[model samples]
Target chain A: MLVLELMVVIFLASIVAGVIGSLVGLGGGVVVIPILTIGLGVDIHYAIGASIVSVIATSSGAAATYVKDKMTNLRVGMFLELATTTGAIIGALIAAYVSSIALELVFGVILLLSLIPLVRKIGEDIPVTPELVGLSKKLELTGSYVETDGSTVNYNATRPAQGLAGMLVAGLISGLLGIGSGTFKVLSMDLAMKLPMKVSTTTSNFMIGVTAAASAGIYFVRGDVDPIIVAPVALGILFGASLGAKALPRAKNPTVRKIFAIVLAIAGAEMVLRALGI
Target chain B: MSLGNPDSMNNVISKVLRYGVLLSAAVIVLGAALLAARDAFSPSASLLHYDPNQIPHGPFPVTFSSLTAGLATGSPDAIIELGVLLLLATPVSRVLFSVFLFAAEHNRAYVYITATVLTLLLFSMLVTPYIPVFGG
Candidate 1:
């Protein structure tokens, strides 16, 4: 294929990934990586590099809207980021030494694991008594956000250490797979930290950019990043994510979750097959 | 004063993030256009080719000096790199901004937490290169 054709194809695919990702609150990397590697026949390393860039793009684009809406809990996000960033650095370094096939297998397994949350429909908004732990209280990691119906839902975080540990694992997967690991982050916040669903999702989105950025530099330094490939993917995801963010409020969560789960399952199976040299 | 107010602080950070994304995307589009134009004019001298196995790998070192030099010479690749750099920098800046915001609010615990996050981020970005085991 000609250079122009290739760019156009990647750009369009990235747009779809970004749109689906934003609507589902998963970010673009999951769709972007599978499409690039399985559909386009791109190398896993290069695909990961491009996916990471798209992750940053989508996160930054959507985060702007989330922050402004006050849906993001900055205090909670910032506190958890310490673990994520550190885990990202470690994961990226480990990735450098790991073989491509091994990385592909790991990615597939994580993709499959990500399905658990979707199946269980965890992280939904249910009124629960806030369990304020010592660390959460000390850090004052509590927040409230106005819902779509204009009702303010206030909440407090608990089990700070558990959330931090979960974030570390989430960050590790994100760096290793070049995806946002949004499911894991949300799980940590919603389950462990006891944050409201809105705050957990938005704050997780807010932290993803920083987590990806930490690992991206390492990827760039290792020469995995290609400017030519990244240009279209980044631009496409950014544009698509912005549109998806606009559409998110009106989109039905159950429908989006089902679609996202199906996509992830197929992508995971394909990745495993590829890893097994199929 | 703005930093002391959570609402204003969030507004400022949001604007920064939005503008940062827009600026980076615009720069990347410009660079992509330049690349396409260059290829169109000289078909034999293609700047991009899609070979998954033989794609360009790890030759270009990204540093401030090289980026500046490439931009000065109007190198399309460098321009694209700059755009990526700006995208990565946006999140880092947000963390930094949070540090100041927390400090202004006299939230000492959060100020410490944010600062720690920022420090870890910088360590990964800058200090990791010197560590031989990480192969940075």
Candidate 2:
């Protein structure tokens, strides 16, 4: 129970969290929260603080590679940020009025519902190219990335209005719960926007940093971001996320989709349990 | 990926993010190392047992003056906080830089869009603390 021993244990646990989080675009908070609160017996506030920092770490660490490899759709990410950031601010303002229990139940249901497409797409490696909407063409929300086979797969984002709306809700929940809500972001891109799984995961990874940063300052000011906790969590997540990032480019889309579905299932179940006060 | 094109913007921003994370990690490692060295001489209990009033709990409140003062004395906590501060700042700086990237592309529409995002970010981080509803 010495301070040195605590740091080493937490640092080791965070590496596993980082790997799974970056692989599925969950930002690793899901893994970090339980490890800190349940395993380390850290206060929930401090755990949240550490998780938020890990979210940023996972985003930046994984994104550094995704962006350079052109897997992240930069234009799509920036365009969507307009909605997510606005939604986040609004969610924060209205959080005082909203019942967190109801919100959790609703989020849980939505996440479970999002699993349908992933389940259906289990057999497909890449998403079939969809007809581009006029708005997509006008916005130029299209890009291409090279697959493991060295062939470039071109893709376009459809249903911009709906996609943006989903991002708004994602941001709202993120601010409301003080969680990254990366599941919703990936769902928006993968389902509503009809983007490829690789792009959705990487783009979600790319954007979560900004989304989490919006609330991270508040946590820091509140003194919840203990340096002893955050330091190991951040470093461990960065290392793990870098490993995940390297593997993702060569990872199959269907495999990534399956991993996302499994993680979503776990997160959704946890939300339901928390809402029920279990 | 033509120069000044939106595609090229990714390359620039990627490098920024990479270096930002690396720099913060370096600072954090230094602080953790310092903490380990300090603890080796005068051992403390696990973080869970630290006094709630101390940095291990919810009382490491950060401010510009306090941060600078602590850094001047080589406080491990402040150094780690600075690293966290840098980590938080990376995405904000990326957004700010994106505005310039958009402007360079001569894409007025995106410039406005990116700028709006940046404004919202700043508002949430810097302005909301004044609003009592947010528990600031």
Candidate 3:
């Protein structure tokens, strides 16, 4: 393909990936990586580089809206960031030692594992009552946000130590795989920390960019980030994520989630197969 | 809104993030335009060609000095790299801003927390590259 044609194709594909990613609550990296590597035959390292950059774009873009809505617990997000950033650095260091095939295999497994929470709908909708809140108070991991119905909801996070541990793993996966690892983050905030679902999701969104950025610098230094590849991917994902955010309120369909899940599963399996030389 | 309200802090941070993303996107689009124009003039250039072991045609600027040097030469890739760097820095800036926000609120605990997070981010992004094992 001509250079322009190739860039246009990658750009268009990234837009679709961004839309699906935001709609399904998966960040752009998971979808973008598969398209770049498995679909376009780009080298995994470059694909990862592009994917991680786009991850920052989409996350920051979406986070702006979420933060404005006051759903994101800024305190919790920043505090947990302490763990995620450290984990991201470690993960990036480890990425340097791992082979492309190994990276692909791990990416495939993480992709599949990420779906489990969405499949089971593990995030709870019930408002947390701020019980068992000693750690949250001590650490100030509590906040209030206005609900859609013009009511205020107050909540406190429980299990900070465990939450930080989960965030570390989330950051590790994000750095190594060049994805946001939002599922793990939501799990940590929702299941481990007992934060409300809205807080968990938005806070997870808030933190994703920082976690990805922590490792993106390393990728850039390693020369994995090609300007030509990342420019289109970043712009495409940013555009698509904005569209997805606007569409989300009206298009919260279970069927859409199911279809996206199946597509991601096939993509993940293909990645695993490719890594295994199948 | 009062400074005590959590919403006030979010309002400032959110604006910063939104503008940061927009600025980076605009910069990237400008870079892409330059690249397309260059390719249009020289039809034989395969800018999209990828090789894992080698950079495509020109030097891919990864360091700040190289980025500046490339920009001085009007290199489109350097502009794009600058955009990417700006995007990566957006979240880091947010964390940094949070330190100030917490300090303004007289929230000593969170001030310390945000500062620690910022230090970790800088350490990973800036300091780690100097370490032999982590850099490569």
Candidate 4:
């Protein structure tokens, strides 16, 4: 009975995380970690392990739909993955040597920092810039995505170097912290590479699975992933993400973004407090 | 040279992603049900607290022979682990599919790039375990 109860609670929390994560273009880890740790009293390592699995679940679930819709920029995502995968390996190696407290502190800071982009872009559609940098032009890293209203939006990605650099850092943080690091990836595409918000978001979604997979192997090897714990979390998130994907086209963007910003703020403070041993 | 129709490639990839997630989720659900049933017979301690030090370290030995043996025994843990393996394989398969798509399009630059990513992914999954320091 207790086992069933635990599974139900964790499963429900994961579903909520997945819904919020898919709607806001964040992976479910941010919410999963807090819920597992603070709400359920799970150890941080176990929470992270399960959360990483949830990230892959949400990423794969959403990416499937985004790819079919032609919202994902495969070219850009593929190109940047080289750096991200390499950085993931390095970060995983570093994680083996670092202390948990230090990791928590870093995770807290990243969570807080991720909110800036969400808050800054609130209530406004980011305009597409016309110019592409030399590298972007050489790679032909531009694409068109159809909006909800059936209008096509074409966008060019500028500053390939900056985007790649940002992805490396994002990957590093993702592997170390066991989160999707989607916020950083979107910031790179939207702010640095000048991709449209929709493009940045979907492409980031597509990229996260591969990034998380890069480090998941390490976690698996380290025995951090418990199948019993991950099974429910992964399955729950998969269902929730699929539902969120269906609703995304009809949902109001500004409202969702505002809700996500508030959630992030609370999650960020909780992480900092936990890290401070409070 | 122009790559094969990017649209067709995207469709194939999307199908792979969708089916992969669905299949893995189904398997995990079955495994969870089995796990719950098994736990009912012999209840273990709470799942919430696990000591990192007490758990056996190193990559799970998921070779073909072991998986077959475990499946024959109907081990719930093995089934759950297999689902996890499939979940991980979804993205890895995506990378592999991209390699083929890039090659079919005769896009040499992307083929090489995608191949490199595939190699890195394989190395992490297959090679990382042997490198003692990574607990392989």
Candidate 5:
């Protein structure tokens, strides 16, 4: 009976997650985990496991559309995998054995820390000026995305010498915290690598699922993949993401924006508490 | 990056080549090590450090160093994790790149109003990683 009720809740939440995930470049998992853990009395570990899976599902679903439009740079995506996957697996293994407590604590800190930029509302958007060697050339990385006027904004990266270092940090953070480091990665690409904001965002979304999957694999083997725990949260996040995305263009006020920082704060606290076994 | 002419293109490509080589090497040698320094696999270190009798007065390991230890699984280099992140980088970068182009064309009203809001939305993440300064 409880399971039946939970299923309904999960379905509803999935819709919510879908909406929220789209609104925020970070996948629904990051949002869903906290709500499920703190608001609904679910376990943190289960929240992460489910969150990552949902990340993959949502990313792939959304990525298909972006890729068809030629927004994604496949070679660049493939190249960075060298660092992200390695970091993810290591991060996950650490989650399982090394002070599970610390994992929980860090998870919370990361979520809360995200608010710095969120609240600051970074307004810096520089043009793509060539600084370092252009990695785009070696990888044949170039694409033209549709601008607001429906005209195309065509650009390429200069080896974005700054991007790789940023990516490594992004990978470590994502693997360490189990939240998609999409926000961080995008910032790095834009500011450090001088890539266009759009490319940085799209590429980070493409990378999160795989990174999450790496840590998730370890959790699964260690018996942390609790479906009961996952079911409600996954469904909730998926739903949230769907809602968030749909609301992106239509929401008159972007209602989700103001509360976003608050949500992050709560999630952070939840992670710290869980890590401490509170 | 003079693309309208063939000779200029060649010159541009060579310059890019030289930069890419120097940059990649720097990243591999410095960035990889700086970030990966904390991302290594050291299981028992965190656990050993987690003496419940210590300061936080909790059963869990709540320190930043311990949390870092948690990220360090058995192996420092985990291929699967790195691959996933690399793959994710594509879509994320694309979106960020797209946003900038869109924002560039906006007026102050649009920039202050819509673009700012959008970027906030863009970087909004759900999970966190900080130690709670105080109990609720």
Candidate 6:
């Protein structure tokens, strides 16, 4: 009976994850883990494994279409992947020696601090940069994406420094926490780099799997990945993410963001509590 | 063309990529679920047995033991679990990072959100060490 309830929780978490992830252009795996730990009483070790597996699943699922449509900048993804993959391996190596308690404390703090940007809307305009002037023209990074407005947006990458800073954050977190940090990645491209959000997100999605695989390999070799814990969460999340992805069009923006905010706030508090052993 | 441009080639590319990713996420989720269920409910449960010996018997027992030692220790070892957990925390961090970017664009609150979920995961894992499931 408890198992069944847990399954339901996982499903709900996935739906929530998908809705929020789609709007923000980050995948739902991060949201799902915290929910499972705080709400459903899942272990972080298992939770991480499950979440990583789901990352592969969801990325693969999404990448197929993104690649087919050519919205994903394979070149850009590949370029950035170098940073993320390196960071992930470094993170994995560090995790193996760190105390789980400290890990939780740090992770919770990062999560709490990471939310500052989501509440505000940054530059919604197209950006133009001298560095990017020849960039979009040369690499085909300049492209269009369809919007709900029924308009096509031709966008370019702007503010290479800003975008790189976001990537640096992603790399650190990937190494430190093992996430794609795609939200930051996409946000950087959209706001700082002045690329289309759609393009940024799609490309970020394409890159997450490679980033994760790097660290996951370390976990696999280290025996941190327990199949028992990984299987259910992974499978449950995948199911929910797909359903949520489908529900994306049907969901509202503010409503979803509010839900995302509230959930994270609670989860953030929970992380602090757990780390304190409360 | 801008990101919001109506007829740019990037617009079409974005839509294709979005849809394509959605489809792939679905299949990966469903297939993994089936496999997980099978593993969870298999009649030959004993075959899925785990023992202390299993840890040391592997091709690289030293690596496994070191992981356990790292986890048992307290400062740096915590990093290994960070990557997988990040995937789980990706959604929440998205908002925080978004706030950051937008703040610089027009200037705003900047929340820097993430953690609630990771705390929970760590809490759960810590407890895993105390509990017995498969007849430990």
Task: State interface RMSD in Å for all models.
Answer: 2.1, 2.3, 2.4, 3.6, 17.2, 13.2
- What candidate 2 gets wrong by more than 4 Å, as runs, is B43-59
Q: lDDT by residue for model 5 over A100-194, one digit each (tens)?
A: 46655765676577667655654433354563344556454555565444666666666454566666666666666666666555556554555
Question: Which has the better TM-score: candidate 1, or candidate 3?
Answer: 1
| lDDT score of residue B72 within candidate 6 | 61
* TM-score of chain B taken alone, candidate 6: 0.30
The candidates' DockQ values read 0.65, 0.61, 0.65, 0.48, 0.02, 0.06
Instruction: Write one digit per residue (lDDT tens) for candidate 3, span A6-96.
Output: 6888899888877765554456776777677767767777888888887787778777877877767888898899899888888878867
Best by TM-score: 2
Residue-wise C-alpha lDDT for candidate 4, range A1-278, written one tens digit per residue? 25567678888988888787776667788888877777766667778888878888998988898888888899999999888888777776676687756776776787689777667887756464668758888788988877788877788888899999999988888767777787778767766887766677778878888888887876775566777568889988998888877777665546655765676676667767877999
The lDDT of each candidate is 0.78, 0.86, 0.77, 0.78, 0.47, 0.48
| Candidate 5 chain B minimal-lDDT segment of 10 residues | B127-136
lDDT, candidate 2, A1-278, per-residue tens: 55667788889988988888888887888888877777777787888889889999999999989998999998899999988898888888898899989999999988988788779887666677877769898888999999989999999899999999999998898888888889999999998998999899999999999998887767777788888889999999999999999999889998999899999998888788778977
lDDT of 1 at A219: 76
Which residues of candidate 4, in runs, are more than 4 Å off?
A103-107, A110-118, A252-260, A263-267, B1-3, B40-68
Per-residue error for A165 in candidate 2, Å, reads 0.9
lDDT of 1 by residue, B45-114 (tens): 3344556666663244367788789899898888989899889898888888888888888888888888
Clash pairs, candidate 4, are B3-B105, B129-B136
- A best-first ranking of the candidates according to their TM-score comes to 2, 1, 4, 3, 6, 5
TM-score of every model versus the real structure: 0.89, 0.95, 0.87, 0.89, 0.55, 0.58
Candidate 2: lDDT of A214?
83
Model 2 residue A233 distance off true place after TM-score fit, in angstroms:
0.5
Candidate 4's residue-wise lDDT over B1-136, tens digit each?
Answer: 2339878878988988998998898888888888778767764464323433444322333455665677678877678778888998999999999999988988888898899988877876667656766545
Candidate 1 vs candidate 6, lDDT winner: 1
Model 2 local distance difference test score: 0.86
* Residues forming the 10-long window of minimal summed lDDT in candidate 2 chain B: B44-53
lDDT of 3 at A133: 58
Superposed model 6: Cα runs more than 4 Å off = A1-12, A69-71, A96-131, A134-140, A223-229, A243-278, B1-136
- Considering summed lDDT, which 10 consecutive residues are worst modelled in model 3 chain A? A248-257
